[model samples]
Every structure is written in C-alpha cells, then in structure tokens.
Target: MGTMFYGDDSTALHFEDRALAHLKVVIATKLRRGESFTISWVHGPGEQRGRSTVWISPSIPLRFVFDDPEPTTLNPRYLDQLATSANSSGGIQLIDEDPVP
Candidate 1:
C-alpha cells in the first residue's frame, strides 16, 4: 500500500502504489497549471463506511509515498479516465483500474 499525505493534516490516505503513481502524474500536471480541484474516493477496508472528498490546490502540501522502489508502468487509458474526471465539475474520483483483457 502507498500513502498520500495531503495538507498539514497528519492523516494519510492509502492507495495501491500503481494507482498512486498515476494519480501523482495527473495531480502534478493540474497543480503545475495552477488548477484547483477536488478528489473523491471510496473508503476501503477497516475505514469509514462512506466516501471522502478533499480540495486540491497548488498551495496545499501533497506527498505520495510508495512501497516499491521501482516505478510502475503508466497506463494511458487509466490516466485518460482520471484526467477526464479531474476536469469534470464533480472532480476527480479515485476508482479501481479497468480490468485488462
């Protein structure tokens, strides 16, 4: 599992390393362009019953920590889906990766 630390809060959001890598790319791109948006995700096991959303901005402190030393290969299709959601009014929604054939 990977950890994403957002803002000044000590609480950390955990994701799979592969997912975090892709999220980092899309988030970095948006933040680089000075865009602020919200990210939503469903809680996993041993967590809250529902979902959570947070506002992301260039000013906020964000960090992504992965368990693996090597980088995960990026999936264009997954990135596209994430980017599309990032641009939406509802904002980015973290979801499971599409199944590979």
Candidate 2:
C-alpha cells in the first residue's frame, strides 16, 4: 500500500501503488491546467472504513508515495474515465481498477 499525503505529513490516504500511479497522471494533468476539483473514495471493510473526499487545487500541497519503486502504465480507458471526472463540475472520484501484475 502507498500513502498520499496531503497538506501535512502526518495524515495520509492510502491506496495501492498501481492505482495511485494512474491517479497521479489524471490529477497532475488537472492541477497543471489550474483546475480544481473534488476526489472521493470509500474505505474497504477493514481499516478506517468510511467515505472521504477532498478538493484538489494548485495551491494545496499533495504528495504520493508508492511501495513499488517501478511505475505502472496507465490504462487508457481508465485514464479517460478519471480524466472525464476531473474535468467535470462534480470532480473525480477514485475507484478501484484491476491491479497491475
């Protein structure tokens, strides 16, 4: 599991590294274009176990940590889905995609 630290180093949102790699591309693209949007996710049955969402803008500090050193290639279809959400007024909602081997 990898953690995405936002605002401060102490608090973080965790996800699989492969999932995060895909998110990084979409998120970076949106932020690079000065677009701000919300991204939301629900915890699994274990762990914190709740839904959480955040507003993403250029000004906010964001960091992504991955367990695996290598990068995962983005699935174009999934990337398009996420990118569409990022561009939408409602914003992006991170969903589980099949993990890369």
Candidate 3:
C-alpha cells in the first residue's frame, strides 16, 4: 500500500500502490496549475471502512509515497480517466485499475 500525506499534519490517505501512483500524477498536475478540487474515495477494509472526501489545493502540503522503489509504468487510459475526474466539478475520485499490458 501507498500513503498520500495531505496538509502539514497527520491527514494521510492510503490506497493500493498502483492506484495511488496514477492519482499522484493527476493531483500534481492540477495543483501545479493552481487548481483546487475535492477528492473522494471509498475506504479500505478496516476500521476506516466507509467513504471519505477532502478538498485539495496547492496551498496545502501533499505528499505521495510508494512502497516499492521500482517505478510503476501507468496505464494511459486510466490516466485519462483520472485526469477527467480531476477536471470535473466532482474532482478526483480514485478508481483502481490494473496495469495496462
């Protein structure tokens, strides 16, 4: 699993490594262009099992961490979907996709 650390404090969101990798790209692109949006996700299997959403902006500190050192080659189709969501009023919603072969 990978963790996305948001803000200056302990607001960290976790996702499967692959999904988070794709999300990181979409998020960085939006923030780089000074866009603010909301991101929502379904919670994982645990005490946090539910849905959570957050408002993301360039002013906040965001960090993306991958568990493995080797980089993941992202799927272009998934990237397009993610970017579409990021550009939407609903903002970025992470949908986990298998690696493109």
Candidate 4:
C-alpha cells in the first residue's frame, strides 16, 4: 500500500492512492464541468480522526482503485465542500496518504 501527506505547519492531509485516484477522477470531472467538491480525510494512529480536502481540476486524472470491500457513493454537494476546503487551505497535496496492506 502507498500513502501521501500534504499540509503545512498546523494541519495535514492524508489519503490512500486507490481511494485518492477514485476521488481525483470524480473531482476532476466535476471541475471540468465547472463544478467543485469537498474531499476530506483524517490523520491519526487509528481510523478515528484525521481528515483533509483538496481542490482538483478535471485536468488531473487519478489512477488508482479504492481498496475497501464496499464502494463509496458519489455526491456532488459533498464534493463541492471538499473543493471549498482545498481552496481555503491554499491548495492541498498528498500528505501521508497511502494504501493499505
């Protein structure tokens, strides 16, 4: 599994390659259509807390698959929130976000 983390001196954004790729595609498509989304993730030793968002454009294509058993549903409004958060944070990057074993 691979992970990436993006943040500054205060907070951080963490995500997995597979899930991120899927999210990237969704966000990119929305951006292409002049839309936005709110993507977020949490950061912690366990799966309890740690989340962040990123504003992505359609120009960016994600190349990974979500590793969870069940798939996540896509929501336009939710995506919008993610975009908003990403923009507010002065842009987001992969920060400690990785894949699982």
Candidate 5:
C-alpha cells in the first residue's frame, strides 16, 4: 500500500503502489503547469461508504509514500485516464484499473 499525505492537515489517502505512482506523475505534471484541481476516490473497505475528494494545488504541501521501497512501474493507460479526468469539470475521479485476463 502507498499513502498520499495532502495539504497542511496531512490527511492521508491510501492507494495501491502502482496506482499511486501513476497518480504522482499526472499530479506533478498538472501542478508543474500551475494548475489546481480536485481528485476523488470511493472509500475502500473498513471505512465510510461514501467517497472523498481533495483540492490539489502547487501551493499545498503534498507527499507520496510507498511501502515497497522500490519505485513502481507506471501504466500509461491509467495515467491517461487520470489525466483525462483531471481536466474534466468534475476533476479527477480515481478509477479501478482494467482486470488482467
């Protein structure tokens, strides 16, 4: 598992390592371009049944922590999906990866 510590509040949002890596790339790219956006995800097991969203901006303090120690190989398709959603009016909505056959 990996964690994204966002903003001064340091709210931790958990995600799988691979997914988080891809998100890091997309988010960094956006922030580098001076863009601020929102990202949301559905709650996982053992948490509340609703979804959560956060505003992401270059001014905010953000950190990504991975448990694997080694960096993950990012999937371009997933990155594309995330980037597409990030540009949307609704902002980024984290979606599950396609199941491997």
Candidate 6:
C-alpha cells in the first residue's frame, strides 16, 4: 500500500517507500523554484488527517529521518510506477526511453 497527498486541485503528490525518494524529488523541485505548498496525510487512528506545509529547497539533502521507526525495504518496481504516474500528471519528466524512472 501507498499514500497519496493532494495540493489544491492542480497538484497531487504520492509518497511511497520508506525512503521517500519520489516525495523528495517533487519537494526539491518545487522548493528550488521557490514554490511552497501543502501536503496532507492520514495518521493515527480514527482516520484523522494531518496536513503540513512542505518547504522545499535544493539545500535539503535526499534523506529520510523519523523519530522512531524500523527500516522498510523499497521495491524498485513500485518507485518506477510512481515515477510513471508523476510523469503523466506533469509533476516530473519521463526519463529517456524508460516507461518510468
């Protein structure tokens, strides 16, 4: 399973993998371009949703850190699927010849 986050009506962001590679890509791009946006996720019980303003910037290294967590392996195939979807939605460009990257 994966998580999907939305920003207004035009922007939709999907974050999967414990590494959060795709999410970082999108956030970095926006922040590098001086754009700010919101991302919401469902956390805790009762289906409560929490939203946060993501501040993206090129200075932020591509890394994942959580207060307390166990490492989760990421499937390359799943990352490929996410890259494809992002490409289709104009979030990112499709890498050369590859269906998704």
Best by lDDT: 1
lDDT of candidate 1 over 1-101, digit per residue (tens) = 99999986596889889999999999999999999999999988999799999999899899988999999889899999999999999899998899655
Candidate 3 shows a clash count of 0
Tens digits of per-residue lDDT for model 2, 1-101: 88888888987988888778888999999889998889888885677768888887789899999999988777887888888878887788787675444
Q: List RMSD in Å for every model shown.
A: 1.1, 2.3, 1.4, 9.4, 1.5, 9.5
Off by over 4 Å in 4: 1-12, 44-49, 53-101
Q: What global local distance difference test value does model 3 have?
A: 0.87
Residue 81, model 1, lDDT:
96
**lDDT against the true structure, each candidate:** 0.92, 0.84, 0.87, 0.47, 0.89, 0.43
**What's model 6's TM-score?**
0.33
Q: What TM-score against the true fold does each predicted structure earn?
A: 0.94, 0.88, 0.91, 0.36, 0.92, 0.33
Q: Clashing pairs in model 1?
A: none
Instruction: Name the better of 3 and 5 by lDDT.
Output: 5
Per-model clash counts, in order, read 0, 0, 0, 31, 0, 0
Q: What would the per-residue lDDT of candidate 4 be over residues 1-101, giving only the tens digit for each residue? A: 33333233233333554446545654555566865444545554656665655544444443333446555554455455445545554443333323332
Q: Report lDDT (Cα) of residue 65, candidate 5.
A: 90
Model 1: worst 10 consecutive residues (lDDT sum): 7-16
Q: How displaced is residue 7 in candidate 5, in Å?
A: 1.5
Best by TM-score: 1
Q: Distance (Å) between predicted and true CA of 57, model 2?
A: 1.5
Tens-place lDDT per residue, model 5, 57-87, is 8998999999999887667788889999999
Model 3: per-residue lDDT, tens digit, 19-54? 888888888899889999998888888846688899
